[model samples]
Target: MADRLQGKVAVVTGAGNGIGEGCARLFAAEGAHVIGIDRAGADECCDLLDEGATGALFQRIGDRHGRIDILVNAAAFAVFDWTETLSYADWKATLSGELDIVFLATRAAWPWLKASGSASIINFASANARHALEGSPALAHCAGKGGVMAMTRQLAMEGAPHNIRANSIAPGFIKTQATARHLAADPAFAAQVLRKNMLQRLGEPDDIGWCAVWLASDEARYVTGADIPVDAGATAW
Candidate 1:
């Protein structure tokens, strides 16, 4: 969808790497004025987990752009551990990193989104929310993503009247920096994932990026409160 987002103002959090970086670059290529925000390596660096800071950043964006047409909350955090070994602190941290950050950023941008006339919010859920990985410890990951799904739906309902649509994207195992080491080191692990997904391969960041572009563009104006799975059939079976 070339230039599908032309003249749009987009803010992509966690844009320093992985799926966020993919979306920011793709959105810019599609002619959006994209502001890439991350704790590092982006157009803007800020801790989105901090409420005051998140509000201030969005306020500044509103002042500069007058309105925000798109928001991609692609930031997330999780500590992998067996359920029995997962400490309370780790669980809390995961919730703060995954769920709270999205809440804070979206809340800050709500007003500007309403003013955009046609705005879209793309939240990151995970296939983990739908099912557990056979050999992985993802108690916190599942909980956090589940929260994201729930919050996104409510956000969609609230924004519907204002024409500000919200939706979530659940990504499959993509070859991201976070997984590169594991993928290279563990052939058995990689094979297990391949066997489960009907695609028999990993997904790329652009796959999710493309879906986001469609949702952010007028093409998907009717979509909201829906969890779109881009997980290569990880949830289909």
Candidate 2:
């Protein structure tokens, strides 16, 4: 049996860990040539927040790959604090990181995606973008993700004429490397999160990866401008 994404080239940001890593690995496994990008040292457990660095990564991919069949923008930043105590710089940093990276990656990959004949752009949003999770102090982070959804819809409409589809995935509390440290320190918190889910468990990277694969594949050829949630029914509650 041939792979679903054979002969395709995919660019996945935040590919160093968590959901992005899962998407990259799964895309590769499904026969897509994956260009994995993250902030420097992310491949070796370092933070990736440099705009120039991310731009350079995508530029290299465009130069080498010539075409990007799927572009997954999964890079984001958030600081959990109450709105009152959140500093201006912290708020700006979180929103800027997500907005800038998503914009840069999409712009850099535009030509290649256009050339691919049929391209898919997958932007990452959060469940909080719709239903706010209590205690999340970073209101700007929530707002930025909402921006991502709007952007996704607009881009999907704009890209449609070119046979390009833009969509977003709103993930709810998945177990990612970044969140693991916090969850580990507070098992009770983690347990509470799990109990909120209809599945009675938190999500894993593969859960998001599978949704990404479908969205990027021909199977979802007609799907665009939609925010698909892989929240394990967290949104249902």
Candidate 3:
């Protein structure tokens, strides 16, 4: 299990925190040269929403590294509001964050990924992409993640010829800084989530991180155009 990704070059977005950070750490531990990208507090700080900046940054990375063996699009922001109360601006922002960011990052890394001849792209979908979260206003998040899942399949098809594999990880009720805040604000939410979860506990960043490691590793070479749910069976119901 150690050094499963030896000598690989990995770029992980949103690496300053949450699932991204977890994956970055694990990738590095597995002997990949990990580049952590985020708005701040990462190896590379840049606004992923800025198309030009994102392209330029990835170009630099590709040129310097010669190839990108792994690309993890784990950064995104979404607003949770009832559909009736959700503004167009917020809806658009959610799509941009959750859906658009993935596109920009992948597009920027495409050439280098092709160069690798066996690159893997790991995207973050969500349990919300498949099922409702009951009380939470996840309309925008759901749509955005659904787009990611679909886009991943298309990317897999496009990347197949280049030996690049594309896959997604769908998580549920993972405890990150954002979810921690929500759990703090609404203590009952934890109980509600656990009640629906087969594991009866909240997930940690590593819960999703390990799965990404597998997807990024050569062990998953045959796996592509797929979505692996790490939702502790929450989505099973």
Q: Best by lDDT, which number?
A: 3
Q: Model 3: residues >4 Å from true position, as ranges?
A: none
| Candidate whose TM-score is highest | 3
* Backbone clash numbers for all candidates listed: 0, 3, 0
lDDT of 2: 0.83
Evaluate model 3: give its lDDT.
0.95
Per-candidate RMSD, Å? 1.0, 2.3, 0.6
Pairs of colliding residues, candidate 1: none
State the lDDT of candidate 3 residue by residue for 1-237, as single tens digits.
Answer: 689999999999999999999999999999999999999989999999999999999999999999999999999999999999999999999999999899999999999999999999999999999999878889999999999999999999999999999999999989999888888988889998988899877899999999999999989999999999999898887
Per-prediction TM-score to the true structure, in the order listed: 0.97, 0.92, 0.99
Model 1 TM-score? 0.97
Task: State the lDDT of candidate 1 residue by residue for 1-237, as single tens digits.
Answer: 578999999999999999999999999999999999999999999999888888999999999989999999998888878889999999999999889999999999999999998899999999999999999788998999999999999999999989999999999898889878778877788888888899978988999999999999989988999999998898999
The deviation in Å at residue 115 for candidate 1 is 1.0
Among all windows of ten consecutive residues in candidate 3, which has the lowest summed lDDT? 192-201
Full-model lDDT, candidate 1:
0.93
lDDT per model vs. reference = 0.93, 0.83, 0.95
Two-way TM-score contest, 1 vs 3, winner: 3
